[model samples]
Structure formats: C-alpha cells, structure tokens
Target: MNIQKMKELIDKLSQASRAYYDEDKPIMSDKQYDALYDELAALENSTGIIMAGSPTQKVQGSVSEAFEKVRHSEPMLSAQKTKDVNEVVSFAGGREVNVSWKLDGLTLVLIYDGGTLQKALTRGNGEFGEDVTANARMISNIPLTIPYKERVELRGECLISWKAFDEVNTDGEYSAARNLAAGSIRQLDPMVTKSRKLSFIPFKLISPARTTKSEDLKWLASLGFDVVENINAASNLKEVIKQFAPEKYDYPVDGVIIEYNDNQYARSLGTTGHHPNSIIALKWADETYETQLTGIELNPTRTGMVSLKAVFKGVDAGGAILTKATLHNVDYMKNLQLGVGDTITVYRANMVIPAIDDNLTRSDTYELPKTCPCCGEPLEIRLAETAHFLWCTNKECPAKQVRKFSYFVSRPAMNILGLSDKILEKFLSLGLIKDFSDIYELSMHKDQIVSLDGFGEKSYLKLIDAIEKSKDVEFSHFITSMAIPNVGTSSAKTIAAHFSTYEDFRNAAVNDDFDFTELTDFGGTVADNIYNWFADKKNVEEFDKVKSHVNIIYPEKKQTNANFEGKTVVVTGKLVNFTRDGITKELENMGAKVSGSVSKKTSFLIVGADAGSKLKKAEELGIPVISEEAFKNMI
Candidate 1:
C-alpha cells in the first residue's frame, strides 16, 4: 500500500464527510464516497497501517457547539454497510433477523424520565451529543409521555415525510427530505422545528431493554412512537426488500437495516469502533438507466468560465426523466473519456439530483471546444488550486455580458423587477441594451419594446418604471450592481462605509490612494480585485455612464459601537416589513456583518416567517436567535 496515496484518500474522504455532515454542502456523490472508503479499507487491511483520523476506524461525526453536550450511556456505533443481500443473509446465519427501513435521516437518542419526554440528542461522534429536548417535544408524532419511559434511551431516525418536504420546499431549496428533517430537528427554537412537521420513528430501546428487537419496536409503537416498518427476514431478505421499495413509503429511506431478532444473541456478536457485528445496513445501489449521449453543452458564466454538461437522451429513473448531468471539472470528463454520441449511464444521486454514473464507451474522442460557444473567442483552460476550467479568452463575450447584465439587475444588486433573463437577452440581441447605462435608456426603445412578444404597453410601462425606480439605489447595492469581483453584498457594504459616494471609491481604486486590504475581510486577493476592476478602461467608462443616471444613497453608518458591532448576523425567511436584501443592508449599517448561512461562528440569527435551513442550523449551534419584532426593539 502506498502511504502517500492512502494519506491523500483519507484527506479527501474526511473533507467530503465534513462538507456533507457539517457544512450541508455535499461536494461528491454517494458512489464516489463509497469508492474512496473501500479503497482506504483495502489499503488498511494490506498494510496494517490504520492511520490516525482514518474514517474506517471511527464513526464519522462532528459535535456542533450550538446545543448542550451530553455523554451517551453507551457509544452509538454505525452499522456495517453493504449493497449485497447475500452479505446480510450471511450475517443472519439462519437465526431470525428483523429487517427494517434504514431511514435516511439524523439518528437521534430520545431520553425520557418519569414516563415523560425529558431530553433529545443527536448522534454526535457516537458518545457525545447536543441537547435538543425543546425541539423533540414538538415532533408531531413523538409522544410527550410514554408508558415505558423510565429513564429510557430510545434510538430512532428523525424524519420529514415526502409529502411534508414537497409542501414545505415549494421553492425547491432543499434537495432531500433527510437533510430538511435533520435541520428542522436541530433548531434552537422548538417553534421553528414544529412548523417543519418532523416526526420521530423509534428503532431501538437502549435502557430497560426488551427480549427481542421486534418486541422493542412493538412496545415503542404501542407507546405512540412511529416505529420503523419491519418484517421477519426468514432467509427471504431479497424478496422482503423488493416488496418494500423506497417509493412505496412516504418517508425517505436509503436502505434497510437487518439484525438478529433476539437481543441477547445480537449483543454477543460484539462491535468494532465503527460498526456493530450484529447489524448490517443493506444499501440499495443507485438505480441507473442507460442513455445515449447526444452532445455536450458548454455553459459559460458571467465570469467567462465554461462548465461542461452531458446532453443525453432522456431516461426515466426514480419517476424523474433526466437529460443531463454535470461533467464536474476537466479532470472528471477526462477520466470518463466521454465523447459525443457515446453510451452513458445516469442516476439520481440520493434519489434527488441527476448524476452520471458511468460512461461505457472508452472512445476518449470527445473534442472539447477550442472556442467559446457563445462568442467564438479562442478558449483557454485555466487551472485553479482545485480544478481546471475552460475559460473564454475574450472578456467581452456576449454570453458573459448577458449573464452580467442579468446579475446587475438582480435583487441583491439594483433590485430591478421586470427585466427577466429572456427579456435582457432579447434586448441585448436587438441592441436595445449596450451596457449598465443602456438599462436606464430602455425607455428610448419604447415603441420597439412594446412590439416584442411577452411585452405590451402595460408591461413596457412597468419595465420602465422598475428601471427608473432602481436608480434611487443603496450605495452598497449600486456597488454590487457594478459586479466587481470579490465585492459582494458584505464587501460592498464595507467599501460603501469607507467612502461616501461611488466616485470616491472609484477614484480611490483608480488612483491607488486608499488600501482596500485594510477593510474587514478584504484580503490581498480582494483588494487586488478592486484595483484590477477599476484598471479596466471599459469598466471605468461603464461606471461613469451608469453613475450619471442613478442616485447612489449612502446610508449613515453607526459610528459608535452598536449591539451588533463586529457581529455576524444571518437573516432568513420572508420578513414582514423588510426584503431579504433590505434587512441584510440594514444590519450592515448597524455595524454587523451579514452572512447568508449560519455556522458556529455566527453571533446571532435574525429571522422572520418561513425561515429555512439557516434558521435550523442557528438553533443547532446554540446561537442567539431573535425574531424580526425582537430585533426591531433591540435596534
């Protein structure tokens, strides 16, 4: 076993785990993670080198500081996972095993004292967890008082039903129910969790144990806990699993958990640090469907970077027809050796996002475009620290301009309402819009605008009114409209505070007098971006042109230290009185840095109605959560 290769695999796997479990941003698919883990395990077996922090040795988990930490009565080990049904059959070894849905949600330990629900904790690093009693009390199905609850530790999956997920995620913000459920359960405020409509389904009874696994579940069910669906795995495991397909159930399930029915016999099998020998998780292989690759679509972004997407004949998998999947980066495409017209297999990753499982054809004949698909500018491959991406050599590619213009008029920037992407593209193609200034001059083409499809006298008037109204913009928002690299809402607010007007900030960058690096979170890379953006002759001209048409209002920043001074605040949900961007800018003016997501580092979270995952994360982290009304009073 190569030690260097092992180290690299370990690091990559660890990072991916953290990305999914901690950050809620998954970088790789389940197949990719399984492959890496299998390789590491094989290496460890051959070399006898179980390196420190190897995921194979320890159950993967991270303890968030948002809740009160509690030590588990006994370590909650992970189940050894397998896709093969034969392995599960072998593990049973003729003894009757109880097979149940391996619910795809956060594993939670619910504690009850005096026949009343007292505490709830997540499986944080197996032995330690944060107390989430308040939220657990609000679970729709969880009984506040159970008959058998005499200081009992009940283990179960906290789940959000597919129906609930679909209803709550009307905006399609969350990709899976399991994630949304986990987020909902970990909330600091029980009310936030209650509204998400989560449920607890018990799988095991830790203290005051029953004779059999089936008996424990039955008892829990009788006590009003929604125990996981189960069946007797009497050597017909495959047939049983087939009957209980994931789609039939409203709750999300990744696989089935099979274990011995007799509690004493199962306990005698012992355990590794990572998993118990008694229980095994039978994961269903991602159901992939074959399709013919038709072509490759090169999607160019506003920054002139191009991304690859496989355009294939649509195939139905898990009820959704899939036509395309991301090729990820140049390295991934190269490994697949994908070519146009090649045979490919695609599947829904986690039964949600479409992903390419494999490429059967090894033609390696795919010809990456040498010119930008939009502008025909000579393309170049740029290698970043992580991956290589194809880039349009010309900065003034029409695709880039269209995307840039679309962004400039977006809510975070100028907050223009009527200019949709299609409208902007049409306007650009017709020479109605040339630059940021041209957006304001759209009124000049009134006769032409009203004549187009999807446009009329009322709509044209609305568009013009929106464009005119966008002129009285916040200075920070106006700065964001410029689309300055590295200068987003937060940085724009910082820069806005440094100077009174757009001209002072513009001239400071143009003349190289003020140091942007001195500002909060403005590193050398950010400062360099400001200088480079101003250095562009075209950008300078566009800035002056747009400046002449709009009124940039620099809000009065609080000079004295405020309650939120140097604090990190996150706003979520639909506010009663303020827009998302409005509240964020308001917080910035009050001397706080506004973040889009919540983490342990966040000082507080300001929420309104229908707050989503960020609000849940804030609760889990034990961060100070304030309502919009409460926030108003504080201000």
Candidate 2:
C-alpha cells in the first residue's frame, strides 16, 4: 500500500462524500465507491494517518439538521444497487447470487462497545451521521445490550409496523410509514418516540467482521434481534429476480440485494466512490394494466376533504399488478381525464405508489360530483399552490371531531390511558363527546361508560383516573392538547418554557403587546398562529370549558444565572448520570442553553460514555469535553 496514493484516495473519497451528502447525488457507483473506501482504510491502518472525521472511522452523515452528531466506531458505506440481472450474474460468475429484500427506511447503525449499547446513528453522507442513541433506546426491538457482549456494531432499518401506521393515521392524513418512522425517531420526547412502536430488523453486521450474509443474520438472531432472513441463492440474474419478485412478499421492499457471501472475496473486490463493486441490487420491473373505470367514490375524510377514488375494472400492463388507483384531487382527475366510465391505464409508478399512468380511452358522458357523500353538503373546490380538492361544507362533522379529539388525548398531549378510536367512537355515537372539551366532562357519564362494550367497572375507574390525573398537566402539555397547526409538542414546550404559564401565553397572543421575537426560534408564522387560535371566540369557549375541568400545572421558575449560567454547554451521547432528556431538562432549568451540535462558540461539550465524533471534534477544536458524572458534579 502506497502512503501517497492512500492520501490521494482519502481526499477524493471525502470530496465524493461531500457531493453525495450535500448535493443528494452520487458521483460514482456503490461498488466503485466502497473499493476506494476500503483501499483508503487499509492504507490508513498500515500507515496510521486516519483523519479525525474520516469516512474510515465514522458513520455517514444524514440530510436533516434536527438530530445530534454521533461518531461511529465503524463508518457506514453505501450499498451497491443494480437494475440489470446480467450485472448480478457477472458478479457471481458461476457461483450463486443471493437475493433479498431492500427495505426503504432509515438506516440505523448500532454500536455495542464493551458489552453496552454505545451509539446509534443514521447514514448521512457515507462519512458522518446524526446521533440518535436516545431514540434507538426507545425502539423495543433494538437490544440495549446484546447477549454476546463483545464489541460489535450492527446495521439495520428502523421501521414502523403497518398496523401501527393505520392506528396512528386515525385522522387519515399522516404521511407514508417511512416518513412517520423517520420523524418519530428524531422527536425530542422519549415518550412520544416510544408510542410509535418502531422495530429494528438487523440486516448487516458493520463491525466485528463477517464472512457470509447468512452468518450475519444468525449473529443478529442470537442476540434476540429480528433479522430479515429471506435469502434465495440463484445461479443467474433472471432466476434471482423471478425468485425474489415483489409479488412474492406480503410487505413492501424496493429491490433485491445480491452480495458476495465470502468476506475475504468481498474485501478483495472492494468499494468505489458510492457503492461496493462486489454487491448488486436487482430493482423489480414494474407491471402496468389498462382498465375502464366503473364509478368514482367520494370518500369524505376526517379533514372534511372528499377524496376521488376511481373504481376501475382490473387492468394488466406487462407484469405490474394494480387494481385500484388514487385520483388524489379534482386537479388530478381533470388532468388525467378520469371520470365515470373512462378507460385508464394503471401502473405501479416507480414500482411503489400506484398511479394512473395514462388515459387510454376517453368517455364524453363522465360526470363529477357536486355534493359530498357523507353530509349531502355542497362541496367547494379549493386550490392551494399546485393542486385542488373538494372540501365538505360542514365544519362540525363527526369524523372531524373524532379525529381532532383522538389527537388531543394522544401520547403527545394528556396521554390519557385506554383512550382509543373505538372507545371514542362509542362515546361520540352516544352524544357524549362533541369537542375536545367534552372529554373533561366524561366523569358525569361514569355509569354509561361502564355499561359500554369492553368497559367494565375496573376499566371505567382507571380511565376516569387517567383523565383526572391529566388535569395537572404542565403548561406545555396543555398547549399541545389544543392541536394548533404546526405547533407540535416540542414546539409547545419551547413556547411554554418561554412564557412560564398559560395565562402569559394567552395574554401575549390575545393582547398583542408581548414581543414574540424575544423567544428564541419563535418566528412570525408561529406567533400569527397563536394569535389566530385565541382570536376565535369558539376556541376560547372550548378552552375555558377544558380549563374549568382540568387544572393546568406550572413548574417553579428557575433562579436566573446559576452555576454554568454564562457558559454554553453542548450535550452529546448516552448519559449515565441522567437520561439525555433528564440532563437536558436540568440544564435548561439551571439557565444553560442545550444546543444540538458543537460550534466554535460552544463553551463545553458535556459528553457521556461512547461519546463518538462530537467529542473528537470538540478535542480537535480545543473545546473542553466533560463526562455526565463530571457535569453533575459541576452543577
């Protein structure tokens, strides 16, 4: 290995990582990329000049600015992907090519150094990633400590279950499961992340080495971790795709991965600018069908928007399987020439979301609905920037109320126990809950609640107790329960902390004298929303009713300028002294601002065990890095 060549390769790889991470486009294939990375790693190991933030020692960087930076014991590299089967066959030569599902979820790298869960990270730019150890701990399937207890780092996708997705989408407007899973993992509240029921399926071993992919799955399974064990070894590319077709699986997988089973052979093959030359992914070929629409169904959603669902006869295009299609909005309908009795071609667009590919046949007699199906109210076609939808006239629709109420009592808000959609629906049907405020008056329906199906004497009492206990919620929780647009629980907490009480917030919003600019991160949009929410008399009346029944609690204001008052602290990694959340709360209470990452302005980096990259960065920049225990002592 030439030292000069290694330096050149490292510099090129760094440039490539920057291009991919910052630009969202790859400069080279995964195999070519991984080969260069391996070359650099081997060179560095032989001649010890590994950079502090080199790709050879850290996980890849992610896109979002929300998460904390974590240093990986072993850096995550991009996987090789290939659409052609000939490529897979070529890689295998005469040997068998293994086919498996390619999950489209956030890639999580979990490192267990010294028999404890050390760090968790997202693949950002194939060099540095966002630290998400706290969020990973909340995911049940990710083991806190593996049984082997040996130093090891594993890679997997953090995903939300389909059942949980439907449950969370009671309001019928949550984004795709992958989006929600990614969003939930980065949430500030551990409780909020926990309620998401995220699961991890360890797919690859990052460290402690590996020989075969089967052996890697076995190793993960030994630790009681779920591993995707769907492997089909085939002699050729056609056989690989046929065996691992999308139709064969119950769940969704983007493509099939084919990698060399032998670790030595894989290492010999090596990496490129963005992928491994040794591994190849066979993306499934999408099938399309041409069919005629029988009728259009106007489904009224919880938000009072009437969706245009096309009921079409089965159509087949190539090998793609799609029966029902989404019109999305009235604009999509008009653009696609979709109406009752119109002939259309359907295909799995990008082999994912089912879409109307084209209109093959047109019918002049097709008609559009003028009124909503549910309430028989006149529907209004409203346009935002890009699209238009039919909105129902009735504002107090039952579906809307139920959706709003469910969100109000969600884990982010009051977190009342035993409050589900079924129970809420039953209560609503009985004219018990008309708004979110109606939930506070449920004590009056004790006898009626106990009599409902699935509710017995013991259960009913517990539910009432849960509601009663929620009355003493902090001002932040109280604000979240209102379900104001764009104001999530974390934002509500930031606002509540600045205001100190609900009255202060109300006065600021209603009186218009308070300067919202004083609050850090508070923008005009948020302030306008606060003002608008209080401006509505109905909202005020509802809030008053809720306030009357539930006693909102406030924490004692912290004494200003305590120890570490003037000093800026950047908290990183898993804290042994306190939960990362606990330490953050204490630090904020003591008048210190807890920042997400390090800067030249950062006074100190309060680090915990397994305090990866940020600690290294702090050291390189000459910033003081202290342990959690030491931080407690200082306080």
Candidate 3:
C-alpha cells in the first residue's frame, strides 16, 4: 500500500467510472471494480497520503449543468457505497446498515420559501439544475400544501407510475423506467411533462436544518407525501441487498443504498468531495458465463412473425438455472451471429432476464429455420423497413391463439378475474376456447370447469361470476380487449371516444375511413396497425363473436347545464372525493372537457393534497386553481 500504487488504483477506478457512465459499458466486472476501489482506499489509509485528485474525494462530473449553479446550504453529498456485504462489514467495522431501494429516478431538491414551494431543481452536475417548479407541481404525489408551511427544503426522487408509463408510451420502445422518467422531467412543454404521470417520493429533509436524523419519513407520510420505506436493518450489505431484491419488480433498479440513520453519527463521519462516508450504494454482482447454444426455436406470434427463441446450455440467472433466452427475431440472431454449438456470454441484463451479451465462438454456423416450428409451413423472409423477420404464413397457430387469450384476460384488456394461463390452456385444450372471443362463452361450461382438478363448485361459480361481470365492460376496456394490433388502452380510448359507438367504429373500418389523426394519442403506426387488424377476415370474425356476447358501456350522460361548456378543466393528482377518472367523467358530463395536461386555455386546474406539477403550471399561466374539496363544492 504505497502512494504510487494508490495513484494507479485511483486512476484505474476513475477510468472505469468514466467508461461506465460515458460509454454505457463497464470495463471491469462489479467484483473487480470494487476490489480496485478498496485497494485504493487501503493504500490511502496505510500511507496517510490522499491524492490531490483522488476518485474517492470528488464526485465525477458527469451530468452537465442545465441551469444556474447554486451552492447547497448543506453540500449535497454523494453516498458511500459497497456492493459486497462483507466489504460493507469491513468498512463499517460491524455497524448496522439500513438498506433501502435505490429508486432509479431523477433527484429533485425542493425549497420552501415560508410555507410555499419556492423552487424545485434537478440534480444536474450536483451543483445546478433547471428550474422545474412549474412542471413539479403537476406530479400527483407531491403535496401542494404541507403541515409545516414553515420554510423547509426536501430532497427526493421523482418517478413515473407503472400504469402511467404503459398508457403514455403507446409504443413499447422505452427500455427503462428511469430513462422514460428522465425524458418526462426534461420535457420543454409543461403539458407534455404533466401528461407523463410523474410522482415524487421524498427520502430526505435537506433543510430547515434538523439537529437529529429527523426520522422524517413518518412525518412526511402523515402530510400525504409518498415515502420510500426502509426494508431491512442488517449488520452487512449482503443481507440488506438480498432483502431488497425481490423475485420481480415493476420498475428497474440498479442498486441498493445503505446509510447511517443517526444524524450526529453521519455528521461526525463527514464526507469526501464525492460521496458521504456515512452512505454507500451497493450494486448486485451479475453472474456471467459462456454457454453453448443447443438450437434456435421459433415461436409464432399473433402478428404472424416467428420469434427466435435461443436454447443455451443452462446458465444460472438470479440464482435459477435458465436454458432459453429469447433472440427476439431473425434479425437479432443474424446481428449477433448466433449459431448452434457457438459459445455465447449469457448474463441477466439488469438481473431481470437472461440475455446473450456477445458471442465467444463462431466456428460453426446455423441458419434460420425455413419452416414454421408450429405449423410446419414454409417461412417467408420479409425485408421490413428496420430488419428481416421470419414470417409464419399460418394465421391460426396455437401459440398465437394462446397469446391472444392471455392478453384478453390481462389487466389492460377485459380484466377477467381468475382467468389465468392454466385455466385458459385447459379451456383451449377442452375446445371451449380457441380464440380471444371464446372467453365470453366460458360461462356456458361452468359445470365442466367445476369438475376440473383445481376447481370446486364454489371456485368455478365465482370465476363464472367474474367472467359474466366482465361482459359489461367500459368502452376503453372493450376496445383494448379486441387485440387490435398497436391499439393499446390509451389508443383504444382515443378511438372509442372519437367513434362514440362500436357500430360507428366498425363502419369506419369497413369503409376504410378510420381516420386516427383526430384522436389525441393515435399515431400513423397505430392507425395502420388498427386498419390491418380489422381488415383481416379472421380478426373480424373474432371481434364479432366478442361484440355479440359483451355489452359496451360508453360514458354515461348527465344533465348538462352548459355553464362550463367549451371550458377546459385540468385535473391533477388523486382526489379525496373522487378518483381521477371519476373527476374527468363528472367534468365532461358538465359540458367541460377534462384535458390530460394544463394549457393556457384551461379555465381551472383542480388540484388535490399532493398536487405536484399542474398547479405550478396554473400559477405560471396566471390561471385560476382550485383544491379538490373546493372543486367538489363548486360543482
């Protein structure tokens, strides 16, 4: 442990960080990176010689400042971190570590002048950030008014809702939730930001300077602000991260953060220029290995495209051995130069799914199957605008039918409770269901379902009741359940609202006049997909079957006063008196349009307790704003 060695180790770690953040590629494995970082620390400790520009001292300047720089009242210190549990134990000298979810989101500093939110800034370059006060107000989770209107500043992560992300991103191209959240926060237009369904969950009270650690989470929760809960208190980092790493997650997370909870202890520990000595981020060590591909299996999709499924020699993924990884399509296989008997580096990308990172051997070559795996029909290679895909000409593939049925029972579609994959498969095998529409006819076989292994008379009757209830669905759900290509819930709603009736929609499809331009969210790609879906005779037949069995419930009309006729109402956040949809429906019923975003023409921006960004925009636009309670009374 010498000065020279320390300098070399620091240089290596710094280079690694730069490579990861700048290039989106890691030069060293997580374990190797940590070992280097630890060696640097050990050298510094033994020699008492801290390098002038050590990686341990200063936070790497990565994100460029997008606004004016402001020196924090208390310098926003970066957390001290260790991915290894035993290393954290060594670092802490066996002290307790409080572990929590390191939410992948935009960090915001909220300043309260007197009792009002004065300004909110993003963690841009750790010094400066764009003033996003107007946009921040529209987020549903942040409280507009707090118990302590007394000057206090808070630090938290602003995130996107799981459901909201799916709704806004009609195109399923967003790779990570954090990326989508960052894009939403950086949107130039307030309306665009408002529509994204961003929410804030405060983790720290940065200012109004408390002497103690504050245990502020409970207090914030009481004030109706969303707070991230600490899951485990462990003596080591390993136990803590294991506690946090559940089987599945809706949002993507990179690491777990562990910090000293005692305020005085944290203060006494002090901080380096980069991260606090009291806090540290622990990243999971992804296990990777070279595996040989056994063969490529093509699974035909409902879109008539055969997706390449790669069967690799069993590789451990998140503690489980997995043998198959989806190649996505024929182009994916070709792009990666994948072949049977070729060794490929397989690892869980973000600890979610097994992905072939790179091919290690190309001594032997394999070709895409000429025949469809399911139907044994000759495969046709189509040169799509983006890439080549193996097309399965057979439209009635069982795999495709199963997928359609799965979507129909999914939450976004008909939401038929208790109709899972097992039941659907059973019904399909029994010849009770062969298509998505066949679900509507399930009630006819209630007696037969009761006799099935897992089901008794009571369970079968309950499932039948749920299916029968799902028959009378909202217009949006009904349209979504149709399994129209690219017609997701949001797009479906737009189409439903535009057409007003199922008959009108069908007629428009028949006449080739289903113009989607007028709809708020519909794009050319979605419109074209819709047209293609309806044009198929088989799809039309399936639609007819479901249409005959189910009842579509349009927006119920209320007695209109025309008092707020043509006036735009922007509703923000969870209403205590009503749900978001309920408020929108009531407003629309009253001859006012319930818009997704705040605009200059918006007459009223109805806000709830934690109304975040919309209220900020209303203030900026000099538009009048009302609370949910006030809105209820007013209406």
Which residue pairs show backbone clashes in model 1? Answer: 66-621, 66-622, 188-619
- Which stretches of candidate 3 lie above 4 Å from their native place? 1-77, 94-97, 160-172, 190-199, 209-214, 231-242, 248-251, 293-311, 314-342, 349-552, 557-635
Q: Model 2: per-residue lDDT, tens digit, 1-635?
A: 48668767877777655534433333432333555877777778887776655676554545556776655564456665455667667767875545567765677888887777988888765566778887788786676775575788888888776666766655654335565676677666554566566777777887676677777776666565667645646565565466655544433466777777776787798676557766776665445576877877766667787666677887555544556766655655664565567777666643655666667666545567676655566788886433466788888666566677777788768878788877886788789988777888888888988888788999988888888888777788888888775566566877887776677777777888876656644556556677788888788788878888877777668765466676667888887658876887788777887765454556789987788767866785678888777877777
Per-residue lDDT of candidate 1, residues 388-412 (tens digit):
5678889778877778887788876
RMSD of each: 12.0, 15.4, 10.8
By TM-score, rank the candidates, best first. 1, 3, 2
TM-score for every candidate vs. truth?
Answer: 0.56, 0.50, 0.53
- Which of the two, 2 or 3, has more TM-score? 3
**lDDT for 389 (candidate 2):** 66
> Highest lDDT: which candidate?
1
Ranking by lDDT: 1, 2, 3
lDDT, model 3, position 65? 47
Model 2 weakest lDDT span, ten residues long: 22-31
Among the numbered candidates, top TM-score falls to 1
Which stretches in model 1 have alpha-carbon errors above 4 Å? Answer: 1-284, 334-343, 360-366, 380-389, 453-459, 557-635
